[model samples]
Target: MDLVKFFHMNGGVGDASYLNNSGLQRMGIMKTRRIIEEAISNLCKSNIIKYPKTLVMADLGCSLGPNTLLVGSMVIDEVAKTSQEMGLNPPEVQINLNDLPTNDFNTIFCALHEREKKLNTEKITDVHYSPPSCYFTGVPGSYFGRLFPAESLNFVHSSYSLHWLSQLPKLREINKGNVYLASTTPESVSKAYYEQFQADFLQFLRCRSEEMMVGGRMVLTFAGRTTEDPRGEESYYYLWRPLAMALQEMVSEGLVDEVKLDSFNLPWFTASPTEIMKLVEIEGSFTIDHIEIFDVNWEAWKTKKYDNDNDNDASTDDNGVGHAVAKSVRAGIETLVANHLVKQ
Candidate 1:
């Protein structure tokens, strides 16, 4: 697939839009908020600056949605709180929200104004909280390459994004039946996947390293495997396996072409901590400051449940999880798949 043009999250405010299907990612963002806060706090305590005039921060892969601003607000709030506790005036912030060129920046721009108004309205007392002076701008580009001027950024953040490679591997045909790394995929296929991730991730670090000043910090949260095996359960295969199975069933029923199914593979790969650290070490750009790993239940995003409470509970949960995963993946990739099928 053309990763640059095709790999964007579902846009707009429809039911299937990324705004609606991204609860899991939003939950992940909330879970990591403390970690992000700590990173910014530590950066402040490190004598990186004595209340610098401007704090330049960027959220790489910050797709359009409430979560985008939500995280930005958290980062800004933490910076202000930390500065206040340290008896230092908080610096004015330049918040850069970045994503692919095709991303729905319009929605983010509209919401930015709304968020400022809402924050202003919530200020009630003499000692009331006010968000730090901040400027918001849209950066339409890929994070795999340099997106900012050298030594310009003070903090960087990305969540639920780096697992996606800039592009798929060259040996795409090796994993014929699978849409991602699977048990049946050949060793060559797995090796190719690993190589691609390493290349993309190293380039990403190199680019960011150039943009960030000395003592700057970055916090990234994304889907990753605890096991070294690329096909491990924590890998994104949890979602892709069920979706691939459903697509195979469609092929069996003549609803989809088998060739197209075989030719399609997700342009994503999950990295283990070991894999990530190795690339970081090799790149020699930044030190491994901190790393945390955790799991989220597949059905954790569900807002409704079965009424019987015991209606084949295990089976129902499994089906419900699969449906949720399928819907999320569909929202992300439906446009690409539809475009390809139409050309065929």
Candidate 2:
């Protein structure tokens, strides 16, 4: 299987959409912004840490642009409000936005331009607003070594990213004969998903541990699964298996080459809150300030009732067949087949 090409197509598509969609961007930004605010609020209340006017914060997998600006603006505003109440000066915020080199830089630059216009109009004379610095970079491989100076950041954030590993597992390692087939069951897929999540997450925390100030905080949010099924029947399988079948059907219809289908697999994985918490426990660098799980409307699959409360009804035709079919297949391929194809 040509893993690089497959990722370039599938993974690239997902990241592009994430950065371009305003609705999706808003949802992610608002959630992370709230967490940052709350964490700062708690720190202030305890008097454990004082709000520095010039705080350094970063969005590790900061896709496009507005989301990064959203975070930066929120941090500036929060510090301003806190300082006013505490009789301290508002701190200047240094926002570092990081993402893969393949991400859309043009769109990000445009978004930053718009944010700059807004900030200029506000003209809050009491404080200085510095243009946020942006870096095009990847994590895991990029972060394991040192990217930032020691004890340089006050907070770090990532969203809907990091579940993606530096590289997908080798196909030969799972099923030597045919790389295209489902080499592992759904349950096995779920377990492997969590295992990778823990490893990558720990690596991330450990790297951040060195960069973050002693009392620095981090908040991350991403897609996750809830079922304990080995085959991942109730949760992601419903979306994936159909896609695999669809690809098989496509091959039979001569719509695409069997070789391409064989090489393709999901590019990302989802984790349950329990699985995520366990990784945090093991890492032991940062305490759980708060963790919340809520339903994410992915515009695919019918919602269903299950033990994990994550099931979706397959009967609903809310989005038409074409979109429904494509979305369902993509979700399955990205989250299920590709991520857990091999055992960790």
- Predicted candidate 1 versus true structure: per-residue lDDT over 1-344, tens digit per residue: 66677567888877667766666677677778788889888877886456577888899899877778877888788878887787777778899999998888888888888887887787556463445789998998999988999999989999999998888788844576778888888788788888999899999999998999998989898788889999765564567777777778888888888878777777788898999999999999889877888776555555423221221111123446666666677767777667654344
* Model 2 misplaced stretches (Cα beyond 4 Å): 1-17, 43-53, 122-145, 171-194, 234-245, 298-344
- Could you report the Cα RMSD, in angstroms, for every candidate shown? 4.8, 7.6
1-344: candidate 2 lDDT, tens digit per residue: 33323332123224224332333334545555667787655544444255554567777766553454566666666765665676655556677777555445556667667766786698656655333233232332244335588999877877767666645543333321122223353344445545555676788888898899877778788666565442344344544566667667767888757665565655456666787788778988878868887664443223321223221223234555455445534432343444434324
* C-alpha lDDT (0 to 100) for residue 99 of candidate 2: 59
Full-model lDDT for every candidate? 0.79, 0.55
Backbone clash pairs for candidate 1 read: none
What are the TM-scores, per candidate, against the unseen true structure?
0.90, 0.71
What TM-score would you give candidate 1 relative to the actual structure?
0.90
Error of 1 at 157 (Å): 0.4
Top TM-score model:
1
